[model samples]
Target: MRVSMDLELKDIPGQLVLALKPVSEFKGNLISVVHHHEKKTPRGKIPVHLVFEIKPDHLDNIISLLEESGISVVSVDEKRYLEHGAVILIGHIVHTDIKDTIDKVDNTGYAEIVDLNLSMPRVNRPSSASLKIDAVSKQHMSAAIELLKSIAKEKDLLVIEPIGIN
Candidate 1:
């Protein structure tokens, strides 16, 4: 199976090596790597595009190891979702737990959070965030959205579902 990965790494020395070491350790054959040092991501990390080939069964193991090593696997899958959706959540995001929200979406296995933006004006003020979620099918996407809504309701937060395209 051919795998393409987009990674964000620190700019310091040894960071690239740290990212690539997992490929060999997991028995993945590296095809190519495109590191864009000239451009940095919004998070201030360098962006790297890499391609590799590995046995289908080893894919999940490799991904788990990468994440365990503190590398964020933004996206990984054979099927692409043609449909996309975005939603907004208003609450005390930090107190409510952002990692817990991400874990819920990731644990579902059918959908994943592709992007997130959070803002808070003050400790007492409500925080708002926009989440971009991707799924293999519309039904799965709706299910994920429903799960998010449930979480919001439980936390006493407001959830704005995707009503139209931005």
Candidate 2:
């Protein structure tokens, strides 16, 4: 399967090789690599565009390995991140690693967080967040909600699920 990946690597010697190591390690068929050195993010990292083909099953490993090596995966193919649903999570949202929470859904391959709005009353208290998650279809959206519920519970957050979804 053809997969697209956007990565940001730390600007340093050998960073490019370190960035491409994961793809080659996974035996992925390389399609292209667009290294944008002139463009730097707020953190001064360089953006990289990678396209490759690999067995569907190898995707998770490739992603995991790349992340383990400290590459920031900005985005991946959202093939199933089309159908959507919204949910609200209330609690220590920021303290609990909000990005990790969003990643939990996005990594599922069937869903991703499309948008998020957070309301914080004070700098030191819990907050409420509204999130829109897109999935492959309505059923996938439901599954995404289920996954969100599980993650939220683990983080001691309260979940206000979809109105009409059982």
Candidate 3:
């Protein structure tokens, strides 16, 4: 598949070289790389744009490899990046570390929480949140939902699925 990737690399010598290694190792034919050496992210990393082609299955491997190597994969072509869905959670959400709960879905690499709305009536009372999640594709939605449900159960939160239909 043809894909474009946005990456963040530490702004040190040889960092771009290290970032390109994963694409090569994963058998991605390099089409081009646009590295903005003059620019730096708030975290002091350089922004790089790359275009390439590789097998669909190899895409995930390369992304994972890049992350494991301490590079941040900011975005990939939406054609394979994700599909959007929404869900709600009701219960003691804030008490359970909302960051961790969100991370559980995002860490999967196939699912992510893109937007969220939270409501807490009182400090001692329960809370509810509407979460907008994006999965790699239609096929990954169920897996993402299942993972959300599991996390809800562990966190004593209630999961409301298939949002916006009813």
Candidate 4:
């Protein structure tokens, strides 16, 4: 799973390394790290934002190690969406209520529209959009695409799904 964590480290030498050691010890793949050395929290601790991928079961152990090392964990967010797929939609996207279309997918709880790029060549002409969808698994991705296809049909839009989506 992908995890995002907000950590507060004491403003001292080697504190950043001390905080990240636990994550590395647990074999977590580091995705990103943002260290706010110039910015201090109200408590005077340095703030760090970390994004990494690790086994879900190892999260607690990492947290314990960080606390033991004097690192304060502010928050943690886990993203369960592990599968991604893309589709091209050609239609009157803006006119069809883009928010409603995206809401339908997100409302399912298992999937969401992560990215969208729309092109409008001329006013009142057909528009094209590329959408990136993320879900917990490939099955959920397929279901989301199928739902999008059904929505497109009702809206008189064209859904150009990626090849071999099945």
lDDT of 3 by residue, 1-166 (tens): 5689999998778888888898898887888899997898888889999998676788888998899989999999825544678898999998899999999888998878999999999998999899998776666788889888998999899999995332
Cα-lDDT of candidate 2: 0.86
- Per-candidate local distance difference test: 0.81, 0.86, 0.86, 0.93
Stronger candidate by lDDT (1 vs 4): 4
Could you report the Cα RMSD, in angstroms, for every candidate shown? 12.9, 12.4, 10.3, 7.0
Residue-level lDDT tens digits of model 1 in 66-137: 778777777664434534688899998779888998889888977889999999988899999999998756
TM-score winner = 4
Cα error, residue 51 of model 3, in Å, equals 14
TM-score, prediction 4: 0.56
Indicate the residue-level lDDT of 85 in model 4.
92
**Candidate with more favorable, higher lDDT: 2 or 4:** 4
- Ranking the candidates on lDDT from highest down gives 4, 2, 3, 1
Residue 108 in candidate 1, Cα distance off native in Å = 0.3
Pick the lDDT winner: 4
lDDT of 4 by residue, 23-128 (tens): 9999999999999989999899999999998877899999999999889999999988889999999999999999999999999988999999999999989999
Worst 10 residues of 2 by lDDT: 77-86
Q: After superposition, which runs of candidate 4 have C-alpha atoms over 4 Å from their true positions?
A: 1-77
Q: Under the 3 Å rule for N, CA and C atoms, how many clashes does model 2 have?
A: 0
Candidate 2 lDDT tens digits, 1-166: 5688999999989988987787898898788999999999989999999988766678888889889989899999823244678899999999999989999999998788999999999987889999988776677789999999999999999999978885
Candidate 4, lDDT over the whole model: 0.93
